[model samples]
Target: MNTASSDQFNEYASIYEDMSQWPFRKYIEIPSVFQEIGDVDGLSILDFGCGTGMYARWLKQRGAGQVVGYDLTEGMLNYARRRAEKEDLDISFVSHLGPELIGQFDLVLGVYVLPYATTRPELQAMCADMVRLMRPGGRLLTLPIHPVYDPHPNYYEPYGFRLIAEDPENPYADGERVKLELCKNGEQGGVFAWYWSATSLERALEQAGLRSLKWRELSASAYPDANQAPKELHAYLQRPHSIIIEGVRG
Candidate 1:
C-alpha cells in the first residue's frame, strides 16, 4: 500500500461518500457481472477496498457464509463499521492489505480499486495478495477503470473501453505522460493520473498466477432500473465506466 494514496484517501474520507454519492454505488454499476460468476452461498467472501461496506452488505444479502471488508482508509472503515453495526450484519473490517489480514476466502471482490493504485507493481502486488488469500478454485472478481479514457482530458465526456491485453508489461515504466481532467462544479481542470490499459491490468493478473474465467465490458444499462436513474447519472453509466474481470487461483 502506498502511503501517498492512503493519505489522500484519509483526507477524502469524511466527504468521500458525499463526493462519490456512494449510497447508490451498487445500483449504478454491474450487478449481473457478479451474478454470472455464480452463486456465492455458503462461501466466505472478502470485499477489498469496501468503501462504506455496500458490497459487503450486498454479499451477505446474497447468501455469502461470511463477509469481510478491508480498506486502507480508516475513515472509510469507520463509516463501514457504523453501517454494519446499524444493520446488525456480522461483517469484519480491517485497515491492512495483503493475505495476513484476509486469510482464505472462497470469493473476493475488488470494486473500482485498480485505478487508485499508484503504480503497475503496486497493482500486481495487490492482485497477488488477493490470489494468495483465496482457496484453490476460489474466485476473484475485480472492477477496474477501463484503460480507454484513463488519463483522459475531458472529465465530463464519455470514455470508451477496450479488452485487456494478456501480456505483462510495466504501465508506468515509459515516460509517457497524460493530463487528467477533473470537474469541480461542472468546470474542467487537469490533474495527473497514471494510465493503465486493459492490457496492463491483465498482465498484472497473469503475473499474479491467476487463471482467467471471464472478461467483459460492463455498462450501467445492464443493471435493473438503469434507465430510471437520473439522466446525468445514466449518461455517465452508458459511457465505459469500468471492466469486470473474473479469475481463479490455480
Candidate 2:
C-alpha cells in the first residue's frame, strides 16, 4: 500500500466501521456478498483487507470454523482486535500474510480489496496473494469497480457515496484512477482506488490459478432485509458501480 493510502486508513480508522453500515453496503453490497458465500458453518474463512474486522467477527459468530482478519492498516487492526476481545470471539487478527497461510482457508472474502491495486502488476500480485491463501477448490469472492461503472460520480450519492474516475472520458480503461467519497461524523473523507476492466481482472485471477471465473451484479434481493428495504435501493443495484467476481483456486 502507498504511504498516502496507509495514512488515510489509519487516520480514518475510527469512523471506518460506520462504512459497513452504509446504506448500499447494508442493503446491497453485504447481502450480495453473503448470499453468494452461502453456508459458512465450519468453514475456514479469511477476511482480507478487513477494514474494522466487522466481517471477521460476523464470520465467527456465524460459526465459521476458523476466522482470521488480515490488513495493512494498524489502526483498523487495533480496533478489530479490541472489538473481537469485547465480543469474546476467538478470531485472530493478523497484520500481514505469509507462506504459512497458503492453502489454509476454505473461503477468502476480499471485500473492496482489488481496487487498491494501482497498477496491473499490483493487481496481479494481489490476485496471486488471494489464490495463495485458498485450499484447492476453495472459493474466492471479491468486489471491484464495475466495467460499466456509471460515469456520473454523483449517481450513487443516494447510497451515501460516489466514485470519480481520473479519466472521465475513458472511465473503464484498465488501471484508471478512481476516487471514493464518503462522509462520517459530519466530516467528508475519501479514498483512492483503481479501475480494472473485467477482462483485466479475470486474466490476473486466471494467471494466479483461480478458475471458474464468474462475474455477477449485486442483487438487492439477496439482502436479508430486502423485503423492508427501500425500493430505491434497486436502482443502484440495477446500475451497479461495483460488481462481484467469483472464482475457485484450482
Candidate 3:
C-alpha cells in the first residue's frame, strides 16, 4: 500500500463509518457484499484490509466461529478495537498483514480493499498474502472497483459523488485512475483510486493458488427498500458500480 494512501484512509477514518450510509453503499455495495458472504456460521473468517472492523463484527454476529480483522492503518484498528470492546464482541483487529497470518481461516473477505494496491507488485502481493492466510478449500471474496464502471449519472447521482475519468474513452482499460469528488450537505472532498480488470484479478488469484473464480456485479436489489425504488431506477441495478470476485484456495 502507498504510504500517502494509507495516511489518507487514516485521515478519513472519522468519516468512514458515516460513508457506509451513503446511498450507493446501502442500495448497492452492502447487498452485493453480503450476498457474496452467504453463510459464515462456524467458519473462521479473516477480514483483509478491515476498516474499523464493521464486517468483522457483522460476521461474528452471523455466527462465525472466529473473526480476525487485519488492516494497515492504526487509526482504523484503534476504532475497531474500541467498538468491539464496547459491544463485547470477541473479534480481533490487527494492524499487520504479514507471513505469520498464514493458513488459519475458512473464509477471507475484503470490501473495496484492492484499490489500495497502487502498483502491480503491491496488487500481486495482496493476492498472494490473502491465499496464504486461508486454509485449503477456504473461500476468498473481494469487492473491488468494477472494470466496466462508467460515470453514468443515473446510477451515481444518488451517491453524492461525481466520477471524473482521466481517459474518458478508455477509462476501464486496466490500470486507469478514477477521480471522485464527494459531496455532502454542500461540502466537497476529492479522492482517486485505481481499477483492475477482471483478467488481471483472475491472474492474481490463479497465481495465488485460488480457483473456481466468479464475479458478481453490485445491484440495487440488495437494499432492504429495493422494492420501493422508482421503476426507472431499476436500470441502475444492472449497471454495477463495483464487482465481487470469489474463489477457493487450491
Candidate 4:
C-alpha cells in the first residue's frame, strides 16, 4: 500500500469536518447505517478510516460504550485528537491498519475509505482484516462507490470520472455521474485514484467470509434533496452515488 497516499489525508485533517459540513455537503450515510444496525448502546464500535473522527463524534453522541477511530494518516489523527479534545469525546484514535490493530468490536464501519485503496487486492485484504476485528455475529458495514456507474475514461483519473447513464432503473443501471480528483497541492502530477463496482466489492466481501445481511443503493433521493438538486447532483442523487452493504461476521 502507498503509505504516503494514506498519509496525505493528514494535510486536510484539521479542516476536514468544516470541508464536508459546509459547501461540499458530502453526506456520508453514517447515521442511517447506524440506525439500520440498530441500538449500538453498550456496544464497542470501530470506525475504520475514521477521517477527522466525524462519524466517531456521531457515535459518541449516540451513546456507544466505546468508539475507536483508526486511520493510516497521522495528519488526520492529529486533527482527530484535537477534535475529540474539543468535544470532550473519549474516543480512542489508532494509527494502524485493521490487521495490525488488536481487540474486537461489536460493530465496524468503513465509510468512504475502501475506494481510496491503492489496489483491489489491498481492498480485499483490508476487508478480510476488518472482518477479523469483529466478533462472531458482529456487523461490518461499509459504503463503497457503486460499480453500476460508467467506467472511467482513464484509470489514473478514477475520481474524476463521471457517471454517464441518464436514467438508472436498478443498481445495475448507470444513472449518476461521479468525479474523484486526487492531486498534490501545487504539484501538477501525483498519484491517482481507482474505481470499484458493486459486483467487485461483493466478491471481495464474500471472499472475506462475510454474509450479506442487506445491500442498497443510496442517493440524494433517499434524503430531503429528492426534488431540488443540480442536474449533476440530481442525477447522482437519484441514481446510486454509493452502495451501502451490511454483513455479519460468521
Model number with the top lDDT: 2
Error of 2 at 46 (Å): 0.8
Global lDDT of model 3: 0.78
lDDT: worst 10-residue window of model 1? 159-168
Using TM-score as the measure, which candidate wins? 2
lDDT of 1: 0.65
| lDDT by residue (tens digit), candidate 3, 55-112 | 8988998899989999888888888899999999999898776666689999999787
Ordered from best to worst TM-score, the candidate numbers read 2, 3, 4, 1
Candidate 4 per-residue lDDT over residues 1-250, each given as its tens digit? 2586585565666455654552113542443565566787788999988888888888888888889998888888888889899999999998865554444789999887766665778878878877888888889888776665434333322222233332334323321323344332232222233456666777888888788557865544334655654443454444454677899987
- Model 1 pairs whose backbones collide: 164-198, 165-199
Reference-based lDDT, each prediction: 0.65, 0.85, 0.78, 0.66
TM-score list, all predictions: 0.75, 0.93, 0.89, 0.75
Q: Mark the regions of model 2 whose C-alpha exceeds 4 Å error after superposition.
A: 2-4, 184-187, 222-229
Model 4 stretches astray by more than 4 angstroms: 22-31, 97-103, 150-179, 182-191, 219-225, 228-233
lDDT for position 8 in model 4: 54
lDDT of 2 at 45: 97
Candidate 2 local distance difference test against the native: 0.85
Per-residue lDDT of candidate 2, residues 43-102 (tens digit): 999998898899898889889999989888888888999999999999989977877888
Model 1, backbone clash pairs (residues 3+ apart or across chains), number: 2
State each model's C-alpha RMSD to the native. 5.7, 2.1, 2.5, 6.1
Error of 1 at 158 (Å): 9.3
Q: Which tens-of-lDDT digit does each residue in 96-141 have in candidate 1?
A: 7544544588888887677666677888887887777788888889
